[model samples]
Target: MAIDWKGVFPAVTTKFGEDDQLDFPLFEKNLQFQLDAGVNGIILGGTLGESSVLSLEEKGTLVKFAVEKVAGKVPVILNIAEGATRDAIELARLAEEWGAKGLMMLPPMRYKSDHRETVEYFRATAKSTSLPIMIYNNPVDYKIEVTLEMFAELADLENIQAVKESTRDLTNVTRMRNLFGDRFKILCGVDTIAMEQLLMGADGWVAGLVCAFPAETVAIYKLTKTGRLAEALEIYRWFMPLLELDIHPKLVQYIKLAEERAGVGSEAVRAPRLTLIGEERERLISLIDGAIAKRPVLPEYHSIVV
Candidate 1:
């Protein structure tokens, strides 16, 4: 599949049943919701998707399901977060075969590899398949930063294409643009700074809050790119509180709770990640409800002048 590497691509939540099983029917509905709102692509098995606990078989199932469900309307990407290099390589191969348009890869999980090993992990995985790769550079959470120097080294690999820029230093967007030119596409990984990064030269956004508020997320991206900064900022300001939920330790649960309030999803999470309860749950519900109450009446983003 060809990937444009631009626009709003949601790192969507994995829909699970109260029994802790994949909920295909609800998942299909939410996918349609995002597509209807004009998301450019779908990313499965991501951090927001709860990839850590998913079996390789389950990951493969998601890739294949999303590919078939989307039916070429938009690209479907699979997040690769294996703990071993060999496993990452295997997943990369399988992802391509399963019809993932691209791979959003993390620097091999669990252990903190140095710059050299991190480069090797991504390099070796890229070499395993023909699929395009978006290296996830979220050192704040991942512990290893794929520096500009590291990116210079990776430039030779044609398939190691874009990056999900989550270093949290908004200047990194300009730094990446200055250093790499158009060689590597930069997608803002943190929702809180998405508008600032896009203004700074990010090509797209790998958004988390988009899972619940798809239209608002896409509207922000469309409005900004089309030189409607003021319009975008108004909506983005409205979205800030909910967007911050993506940066938390319990992001999966928090976002799902938002999804639940929006009439788009469930709050059932897998074992070891029980559903939110009591005060914490009520606090988030208050926030989500409050935001939904004042949801912006958006402009016709699809018809915006470029």
Candidate 2:
């Protein structure tokens, strides 16, 4: 598939049944919402998807389900994050076999590899599969930063096509564009800084909160791309509070609550990840409720100007 690697590509949460099984029905509903909202692509088994908790079999099921559900309307990209190099390679190959159009892979998981080791991990995974790869550069949570020099080193790999820039440093976006000049596609990975990064020439968005608020997320991207900053800012400011939820430690619970409030998916999560309860739950619900009550009526999307 020819991926433009630009626009909204939501990092959706993996819906789970009360029994902690993969909830295919709700998952499909969420994907449909994203597709209907006109997002550019769908990324499955991401951090927001709670990929670390999912088993290999469950991941395979998700890949196949997303591919079949999307039916080529948009690309279905699978995220690969493993502590070992070989495991990552195996997952990448599995994604390809299951018809994923692209791979969004992180550096070695759990173990924080140095620059050299990290680059090798990504490069080895890239070599082991034919799938185009988006290197996830999230220094904040992952603790391993893929610096400009590291990216420059990995630049020779043809399948290593794009990046999910979540370094949280806005200047990194500028530096990437300045250095690569679109040689490598850049997607904003942090929700809080999404609008700032997009305006600074981020090619796309690998959004987290979009799983709950799809339209508002898409609207921010579309309005910004169409040179309608005033309009985009209107939604961004209203959406900012929810966007901040994406970066929280309990992001899964927070986002699922938002998803429930937004009428997309259930708040059920796997064990070790409890459903939000009591005052904690109440506060989040209040945030979502307040936003819902005052939600802005977004203008229609225009043909992307940039």
- TM-scores of the candidates are 0.98, 0.98
lDDT of 1 by residue, 281-306 (tens): 99999999999999999998877533
Can you give the lDDT of residue 51 in candidate 1? Answer: 92
Per-residue error for 44 in candidate 2, Å, reads 0.8
Q: What are the Cα lDDT values of the candidates? A: 0.91, 0.90
Off by over 4 Å in 1: none
User: Could you give candidate 2's per-residue lDDT for residues 136-161 as a string of tens digits?
Assistant: 99888989999999999999999899
Tell me which residue pairs clash in candidate 2: none
Clashes of each: 0, 0
